[model samples]
Target: MEYEPAEYQKLQVRQYAPRELRETAEGKYWRQFKAPIVAKQFGGVTHIDFCQQYPYNLAVTASTRVIIYNGLAPAVVGRTISRFKDIAYSGCFRSDGRLVCAGGQDGVVQVFDANSRSVLRQFKLHKRATRVARFGADKLHVLSGSDDVTVRWWDVSAGSQVLRLDGHRDYVRAAAASPASSDTWLTGSYDHTVKLWDVRAGGSAMLSLEHGAPVEDVAFFPSGSIAVTAGGNCLCVWDLLGGGGGRLLKRLDNFQKTVTCVRLSPLAGPDSAAAPRMLAGSLDGHVKIFELDSFLVTHASKYPAPVMSLGLSPDCRLLAVGMADGNLSVRKHARPKRAGVGAGPGAPEPRQRRAPRLTAANYRYFIRGQNSRAAASDYRVVRQRQVRLQAYDRMLRQFRYRESLDAALATRQPEVVASVLEELAARGGLAGALGGRDAEGLLPLLRHLVKYIAEPRYTRLLAGMAHRLLDTYSGVVGTAPAVDKALGVLRDRLAEELGVQDQLSGLAGALEPLLAASLAGALF
Candidate 1:
């Protein structure tokens, strides 16, 4: 006897299409999951930030009001009318999620209790519009930057200005506090400069760096050793640890429009070994997440309107985007898969287990030259094994409808069974495979198909095949009571699904004639 190479043995195998893999667990999780909630604001949403505390409430600012939403998915919790005289431009949630702070175009900085919606403190520090306001590293201080070219730190409990830093020649737009300490912070200005400051040192900036364009937003990496600034169409990164005047690390410019906002992932804590990726929202309707060191876009998502504000939850499990069209889009992160879990119990078990690499039968174990006594030689442990290829899959790929139907029925694999049924239905060979009117010849296959008719994963495919099978064998199929009962249930399910499709089709058909009449009327 001659032995052929494994590659040339002509064992049956099917080339799986990309869509077939979509039926796998990971694919189904990503492709089929739907967003559980979506809500709209009255005006363009200026900002959306999630609370740092448990229950993870969200703060949304639009027009003249600030609304706090509670729960994992957004639902209104409480709201506050910040300024009656003018629009509220910014809103932020404190580290404890107990306080909500916002800045108004009327130059007022207000802090309110998140739950009661009562104003805790209000500071009238800026002479012009207050563009941004946020709590510092500590709850005792609140920072606000305004068009008046000033950055003021107000004592929240004391309700007095602790210090005022004024150096920019133009309007101050964005500011961020360092996570490492409350004394340190960063602010961006329309004067084309980014200023690093220390609240401990009175009224002067510690360092100032030119950005060559009006700065839009500023954020500090979780470690506080790196600062990122968005302006015009570029993102500039600076190294706070570079000693001599904070070195320029890298400049990123992927957007064609002005970058509106930039935020660092809160998941990357101070003790993290690596810096967090940065999320930048731009006027071009895209939010780009970039890897810190590489400056490569790791992930990106698009919205129907320009992305004005972006916030990542403390756990990094959810991201909320505020769009220019007042649409708030929240996306949940895909959960990581566990290592040892497998397909459900209905999955087929392996028929043959793998043999040991070197069993006692192949290599006798010896210790100190004594005869091998390690369970000695065992033929069962050394036997060669090969997987039996799934015959139905290969036959279906080869277009052998009749043979594939029989092979699939024998294997009892629901997915393989559905594939064969779908292919037969698609190719107009379903009747031929059933051997019309020959009930004796098709009863076994019908029994196999009936076993999995109600399975959600394969119901649609089996339902159509069942309908065709019944029509072809209507005269003799009802002779068996058990088979007839199963067939009746399948018929009922298919009819219900068909009714839904018909209603939708009717709606679409009605719109066609109305659209044609409208076009004719317009022409006349």
Candidate 2:
């Protein structure tokens, strides 16, 4: 509305360091980021990005990670694609689906073989981070785009660079080669242009993507007649049939932020008259789908974190969506057998949506925003917290009390559970998760209140719940000596109904409740 200039201009997202980047940059850039903001302007469904729940892939930004869900049941399956030491600018799958190649801010391209969980190789490409990589027309060759504004070729099998494709005025953000032509390639740059490359002719201007903002990603449709691009928030499909001219097939104008990833079906429509299905993800945490022929958005998935990467398996039924958080989700698209209007009671069962198969090996895990040195730091913190939680939970099951307390106090059994929670507190995880809700987390939580929390200030607030439960049962009859003595005197007469017995006082003093459950009604 009004221009107010301070002493200096604000730094851009690129200028901010990984740790120093602005908080909520996605909402700031996507003016209509908030729901109310969108509803105020246009009364329509705002968020539409399809988020996968299975772990088929991971998308990384700065130090945060987004998992790509492989459309499996309870999606967000598979291993995380984590292994990078710094912010990953770009990444892609190998031709065989075994290797994931990524370029980081340190000007290094690290190749991680999915099956081995090892870094096969890491080599410096340009002074700046590399952005994108595409398989050469034959799949033997590899091409990478860089911030230094050059495209380099790699002999992937040899693990060495064979040549560099130069000739761009600004940083090249996207690079792709025509699937049919061995010598032909295309690269899009921040300089507001996409150029065609001919390997035989040796690095010269071939064509450009005429768009408003810098091109983030580009891909060729199966027909090769057009190339699709996710630029800023808009989706543009350029006509490649006519010398690759900037013929717009369709555009979605209301996307609130930059587009993250896009995928198009390899097979066009079922028959000649069918339209292709296009899926696009964005930084605002939405994946939108459009029918290529009609240019209409037909489906969407809303996510809590920004989507950073995406992939589709050999069959398009499984769509993997990656979020800025360290969770990948895979969503299965199931079409009803009967397409038109619904009519039958026993329709051939609505097909189930499922995530693709994901294992520790082929999991698309995005290791983002972590420097190599910092990766070591994150692993230590994340893993230590995990183990601490398990230990704390195990200690609180509270199988039985009276038969165990005297022995536990004597053998340090309660002390051990207390010690474990202390260890977790040292790591800073259990204490936070247990917060106040730990009252019922472990039965021992009541047995050992000081272990989870030193102060029971809020716990006495459960007096009402205690009254309700007690209304249905008798008092535990222990807190005071008089009540204990009276209960003991009356125990013999009520033994048959309450199932009480004068058990041995010897062996019961040494075993845990679980170990104690094995030996019932034995005082000896």
Best by TM-score: 1
TM-score, cand. 1 vs. native: 0.61
lDDT for 154 (candidate 2): 78
Cα error, candidate 2, residue 456 (Å): 59
After TM-score superposition, the amount by which residue 134's alpha carbon in candidate 1 deviates from its true location, in angstroms, is 1.0
- How well is each residue in 1-524 modelled by candidate 1, as lDDT tens digits? 99884432322223334444334332233233246246688888888777777556778888888877764555454565554468887788888778888999889999888877778898986899998899886787899999999999899999999899988889999998898888898999999999999988967788998887899999888778889999999999999779688888999989989899998876442223345668899999988877677898766667789888988766555678888898887766555222112222222344566865554556543333354445546443455667445676566557677777888778775666666666677778776777643444566666665566555566666666766776767777657776676666656765776787799899999999999999999999
lDDT scores in order:
0.75, 0.53
Q: Can you write out model 2's per-residue Cα lDDT over 55-111, one digit (the tens) per residue?
A: 223322223111222323323334344566666655555554456666766777766
Q: Any residue pairs clashing in model 1, and if so which? A: none
Instruction: State the displacement of the C-alpha of residue 149, model 1, in Å, after optimal TM-score superposition.
Output: 0.9
Stretches of candidate 1 off by over 4 Å are: 1-36, 268-275, 333-382, 387-524
lDDT of 2 at 138: 59
lDDT of 1: 0.75
Clashes (N, CA, C under 3 Å) per candidate: 0, 52
TM-scores vs. true structure, each candidate: 0.61, 0.48
